[model samples]
Target chain A: MTVSLDLSDVTAHYGNTKVLEDLSLHVAEGELVSLLGASGCGKTTTLRLVAGFLEPTSGRIKLGETDLTRLPAHSRDIGLVFQTYALFPHLSVRDNVAFGLKQRGEGRAARQRKADEMIERVGLAGFADRFQANLSGGQRQRVALARALVIEPRLLMFDEPLSNLDAKLRVDMRVEIRRLQQINGTTALYVTHDQEEAFSISDRVAIMNAGRIMQLDTPEVLYSRPANLFVADFVGFENVIPMRAVAEAGDAVRAEIEGGGMIDLPKQHYTVPAQEFVLASRPEGLLVDTADRTDGLPAKLGLRTYLGRAYQYQCDTTAGPVKANGPLGTPREEGEIVTLIPQPEQCCLLPREAK
Target chain B: MQRRAHPALIAFAVLTFLFLIGPLVIIVGAALSDTSYLTFPPQGLTLHWFQNVFEISAFKRTMITSFQLAVGGTALSMAIGIPAAYAMARYRIELPRFLGNVFVLPILVPEIVLGFSLMKSVAVGSGVPIMGALLLGHALLVLPYCVRVVGASLNSFDFSIEEAAVSLGCPRWKAFFTVVLPNVKPGIIAGFILAFITSLNDVSISIFLTGPGVSTLPIQLLAHMEQFFDPTIASVSVLLMFVTVAVMAIVERTLGLTFLTK
Candidate 1:
């Protein structure tokens, strides 16, 4: 049966070192939510806490209405797919898949039947009798997935499960995992350091830093309107320039870049921060205006990199070093003077960063 | 370019090899001597001394007792040390480095001193039976190998697989039995074999603890040497040397000899 996972104000530590600090999350039933962050950003710790491997120093974890704060992992009815696949090397595919059933006292004949059915479903029908040592990397992961899913656990968790797969296989395997989870309608929490993987697979993504989640929202909103500079920067916002509002009209806002430029943006396209704010954009969003010093921030180009679709310019601005995309049709040479125009459609105005 | 050794260095290396393996070659050769007494060169080859080891009824009983102690002691050491090593390897204990050092500390004590201490504490002072006391001593003597070898195996194991079992609805301890135990089988078997050999060949510990009727095979061999200097003991040693080599080869094939270093 499916159950929602709720982690409320959980704080955890390793001896004196704090890992997750008063973190709270609620994953809706049948929904897949991803915890996205760099390595050691406490994403794995959060998954471990949910799986009942690590107890929280404070607060509670709930699966549906069940209080799981002190539940052992096996009793929690949660499945975890590790990056290593973690398949039992000694057991054949059938036995490995049937292990959970056997432990819960399922009869031998019954469990074997169920395990065989699952082996076939995961595309390893004839290979059930083969040992893990005989399987390829993809086949091994498929076994791991089938073993976790066959239990029909209340919640399924993935800890960078696709990180070990090559790029092409990673895409295919993620699709496979997502298909099975959908067929079962099990709530899942996925932890990954890859932004693309999270954005593509999850219904919503939580970007974490240190121990706190900076923002949790749909991938679209997180990409377009991140709540703060950190979240903005995490979603490919390469330039963050502080700006003060000079004037405002009904559908337009005129702002002055901190250094030496003026810009006008559509009011509906970007958030008008109540006070002085920071403007963030991706390299593609921060386009180099061909004009030298009009309608944008003044910059001097340092280095140019030819991206397949565009030539990216590393330009020095009074704000800091800024990377912006210049049109390949009219490439800018190094040491050339340029101006940067921020496209509100690809930009967001964030409140000052919280310390 | 490979460097060449000097003439003096080559001569010194040859002497060292002879010094190390010289006694073993002499014993193997003497075991085949036609003469009844144990003598090396100038003797016609015969297999009579090899057959003599199987003739003595007293020697048979001692061999039985020695085999029993080796099997029983190795079993007890594994029963205690596998779980203990698992704890030391898998969990974060207080002063883990210090605890690891203490776990393998039994090997640091001289075998003779350990034997005397065992006899004093277990047999005489503690009022234990002779066979029980000897078994306990052997188990204690081989515990370090059990811990070291099994601990090395457990250390290199991917603990995540254990967690995977736990996640798959296996109880924590049951997970250890089904998952952890089977994966580290090579190390466990290697450890058991090593401990078995140590118990089988133990002399100093057996000497201190042997009462009237409870001497081990090695103690009986020592007694036989005192009565007659025959090639019978040499034949037994050769057989044991071959057994030890076979066991070592099996361990090397299965777990790789580098596990000992681990």
Candidate 2:
């Protein structure tokens, strides 16, 4: 059965070193949410807390109507697939999948039948009698997936499940996991550090930094409109220029950059009121023109690279080295001066904070 | 690049193997001698001494006693050592290095000193029964082997498997029995055999603890040799050697002999 998981004001620490600070997140029923961040950003810690492996120093965790904050991992009715695909080496693939059913007191005949069905579903039907050590990495991953899903847990969690696979198999398993989760409509929480993996599999991505959630939004929204400097920088915003707000108009504020350039930002994007703000834009959001235009900032092109489908150029502007991607045409030579224009709606405004 | 060993090195290796196994060959040969006196390169082959081992009541009683002590000591050591090993491997035990040293201290002490100490403390001071004192000493002497073997297996084990079990609706204790125990079974079996043989072959400790009527097979054999230098003792020694080899073969067939080396 599908269930919503909610964690409010959760704080955790490992002996006196604080790992998570007042982290709160909610996953809707049958929704897949990914906690995405770099190493030591508390993404794995958050997943462990939700899985009942680590108790929060202060917070309440609930799955639907059940209070799971004080429950032990066995009573939480949750399933976790480990990064190493921790299948029991002594047990066969079928036995590994039936482990949970056996624990639930299922009859031997019934458990075997169910395990066979799950093994077939995961494409390991012929390999059921094989031990984990005999299977390849991709096959081991499927066994882990089957083991976790056979129990029909209330909430399913994965800790970098695809990280151990080869590059091609990683993509295949990612799509397979996403398809299974959708078909089952199971509430799932996935943790990963790769941005592309998180974006492709997750319905919503929660960007975490320094043990706190920086932004929680859909993949498209998070890419287009990050909340602050950290989220923008983490989500591939290569150009961040400090600006001072000079004028406020209807639903828009005009800010002046350090190098005598001005841009208008929507007022609703600002989370805090400040005279100093930061303007952030993705590398693809800036348009490059060869002709010297009146409405564009002048910059000198430094390095140009051909990225198969597009030409990416590094431009030295007043805001520092800005990266932009354009159509594949004539290669731009080094030291060529070009006019770069930031797309109006693609820019985000944030209150400047100490880095 | 690989090169063949020198002829001198091969000769040295052959000599070393003979040096190690030559005494056992002499003892087996003497056990088959037809004459009453023990002699290697026997004049004639006979199984009379082997049958004589069964006729002696003291031999039969001491053999049973040794078997009981080995079984009891091995079981006790495993019951205590496996959990201790698991705890030390999984959790952060306080002063782990110091505690590990404490568990292995018995092995480092000289067997004669350990025997004397147990004689004074357990036999004289505590006034435990002779059999009890011998069992306790054997268990203590073999505990280090159990801990070391089982601990090595646990060190390489991935603990996340147990956590995976607990997350799948199995309680922690059940998870341990069903998951952890099965995976480390080879280590347990190896440790048991090592401990059992150690108990069976012990002489110094059993000498200090044996009362008037209770004696281990090794101690009884020592006492018998002081009175009679016959081929019967060699026959008993050959039988004990056979039992040890049989146990090792069973271990090899079931769990592979690599566990012992590990």
Candidate 3:
């Protein structure tokens, strides 16, 4: 059965330093939500709060209709897969997977059967009799997942589960984890500092900075339309140029850029009194043309790198150094002058305070 | 095809090994002598002094006392040390550095000073019985070993396993018993053996605490040696050594001695 998790206006502190401030999130039933942020940005703390390892200073945590804010970790009926795997070193893989079931006083035969099935599901069938010390990093990670899932918990949580893995195994394990979660229809909260890993497996990613969620949306939406300058820059929007709004239309506003140029931006996409604002766009959103063009900004190319699939060019423009990607077939020289044009729909307008 | 070790290094290593264990060999040789006086390279080999050890009534009583003290002290120390070490290792106890130094202060103090301090505080000042004083002293003496060994074990332990158990529907205490205890068992066993040995072989502390009708084996042996110089003491020492070795072998068979070295 699937269960939803909700945390509303939660605030947590360690002594006098506030680690999480008024943080809130909701994970729909059977959906995987990842809290992605840099280290010490309170992503792990939020996961721990949901897993009952921490008690929020002021907030309400609910699973379906039941309140779990004050419940102890054991009574919460949640499963957590730690980054270190944290397998019981003294027990074999089978017993480690059966630990949660055994704690619930299940019969030995029942535990063995459930543990065996889960172990096979996690692709650790032959590792049942071996201790954790004998297994490789990937095998140990699978054991941790099986141990957490075998109990049929209401909610599942992971704290950087694949961080210890090698690059190749990390990709494989990410797919396996997502597949298992979907098949089981379990509500899960994953925490990781790696943005690519988070975007790969999570149904939706929440970008966090300074203990607050900057944006919560699908990975595609987050990449295309970021809410603020922080989310824009974090999600690879490298070109952020300051703009001044000259006039407002029905839904769009004409903004004056540096070097005597103008661009029309949708008013609904940014905050209102736009005295000082910034136009943000990803490198892929900008098109570079070596031939002279009247409708685009003039710039000199600095460095051009071949990224296997596309050519990345760095241009020295009035807005500073703007990076753009183009097709590999057309090679542009370093000192050549080029016209850089921004695709209107792919760019975002944000208030100056967001900086 | 392998390269040979230098002759001077080999000779130095042999000399170091002999320097460490040469006295034990002499004691065992003297224990097997049939002569009345203690002598190495005996004229005749016999087990006569071992039997003579059993004939003395005081030796038998003191041997029982020493066994009780070692066992009781080790058990008490473990009971007190596990929780102390766990708190120091896991919780953010206030004044942690100061508390750690206090817990291990017994090992740093000279044995003679510790014995005198215990005699003044627990035996004379508190007016406790001689046996109680000895038991308390031994417990204090061995407590540092338990804390240090168990603390080291807890340091390498991954605390998330305990958290996982708790999340899997086990209470905090049950999680500790099921997960933490089993993981740190090797250290527990090693600490118990070390504490037992330390309590068993204590002479300086036992000498000041021993009174009439209550004395440890080492104190009794020392008293016997003051007047008589014979091979009986050597035989007793060899027996004690055998008991220690037998205990160590049992430990090595069950939970390897690598934990003890750690």
lDDT of 2 by residue, A233-319 (tens): 988787887778788666877767777765555656543247887767787777778745644556788888888977889888776
Q: Write the per-residue lDDT of candidate 2 for residues B1-262, one digit (tens) a residue.
A: 9999999999999999999999999999999999989897986999999999989999999999999999998899889999989988888444356776777888999888999999999999999989899989899889998998888888888998999999988899998899999989888889999888889999988888898899999999999999999999999999999999999999899988888887
DockQ of all predictions against the true structure, Cα-based: 0.79, 0.80, 0.80
Q: Which one wins on DockQ?
A: 3
lDDT tens digits by residue: candidate 1, A1-355: 7789998999999889899999999999999999999988999999999888989999999999999999988898887899999999998999999988887789999999999999998888899899999998899999999899888889999999998889999999999989889998999999999999999989999999999999999999998988988898899897888888888755778787787667776766776785688888898988887665455778889889999999999989877888899888998788888788887778888876666
- Where is model 3 chain A poorest over a 10-residue stretch in terms of lDDT? A264-273
By lDDT, who's the top model here? 1
Interface RMSD of 3: 0.8
TM-score per model over all chains: 0.92, 0.93, 0.93
TM-score of chain A of each: 0.95, 0.92, 0.92
Candidate 1 predicts chain B with a TM-score of 0.94
> All candidates' lDDT scores?
0.89, 0.88, 0.88
TM-score of 2: 0.93
Between candidates 1 and 2, the DockQ winner? 2
lDDT of 2 at A167: 89
Sort the candidates on TM-score, descending order: 3, 2, 1
